[model samples]
Target: MAKSGNKMATLLNLILVLSLVLMISIAESRKLGEEAVACDSVYGAEEGDTCESVIQKFQLGADFFLSINPNLNCDNFFVGQWLCTEGTVN
Candidate 1:
């Protein structure tokens, strides 16, 4: 009857919410693992430091800089941000 249909819909909604939570948890775990990088050297950003400036100062290749700092957004980079001058992504 109507009551039974309502119960079924509620149960389905609960299941859907739980499934979404599980998916989010899995995605977050994977992201953490991917972002884990071990740094041999680090550099703190100063005023007027662009990605290019940092790379040139350290004599680093563009590709190498990107590899070490996988999550870096060059356009929005801020002063006081610490970057890996030498590192390996795990």
Candidate 2:
């Protein structure tokens, strides 16, 4: 009985650890995606690109860019990055 209880406890601990790791990984991935610089426009976004260039390509202004990507920095952009900027009104 004691051995079974220990095994259950170990299993529960393992599950908890795995859950934490998964949560951390998900958060990290979201951060990386945010750090990336892709436009959220369905019309003009490729797999690897930056939102800055996309906004330029689309002829959008700085305010428009900010309105679109609230979490992004206009000055700093990265290559092969993607950003979500939908539902933003000009």
Candidate 3:
């Protein structure tokens, strides 16, 4: 009887720890979703707009814009170029 009781107690403790971890994960997921913002540009790139200018107007630090748009040629951005301004890359 004593051995059975000890086993039950250990199982309950394990369950409690698992529940706590699950709850923490759920809360963190919610927080991350709330913090995430959509990455869409309102205005298209105008004629003669450079990648550096776009980065500056969007408040992105140097290299951040290029990092977001890997296909984009930083030094050869044409007017009317569109790009994503937010969201996870992968």
Best by lDDT: 1
Q: How does each model score on TM-score?
A: 0.59, 0.39, 0.47
Model 1 ranges off by over 4 Å = 1-36
Model 1 per-residue lDDT at 50:
89
Q: What would the per-residue lDDT of candidate 3 be over residues 12-55, giving only the tens digit for each residue?
A: 99999999999999987674533333455545778777777777
Clashing pairs in 1: none
**Least lDDT summed over 10 consecutive residues: which range in candidate 1?**
28-37
Q: In order, what lDDT does every prediction score?
A: 0.89, 0.64, 0.70
lDDT by residue for model 1 (1-90), tens: 999999999999999999999999998777544556788999989988889999999999999899999888888778889989998866
Off by over 4 Å in 3: 1-43
Poorest 10 consecutive residues of model 3 by lDDT?
Answer: 33-42
Error of 1 at 76 (Å): 1.3
Candidate 2 lDDT trough over 10 residues, lowest sum: 31-40
- On the 0 to 100 scale, the lDDT of residue 80 in model 1 is 84
Model 3, 63: alpha-carbon shift in Å? 2.9
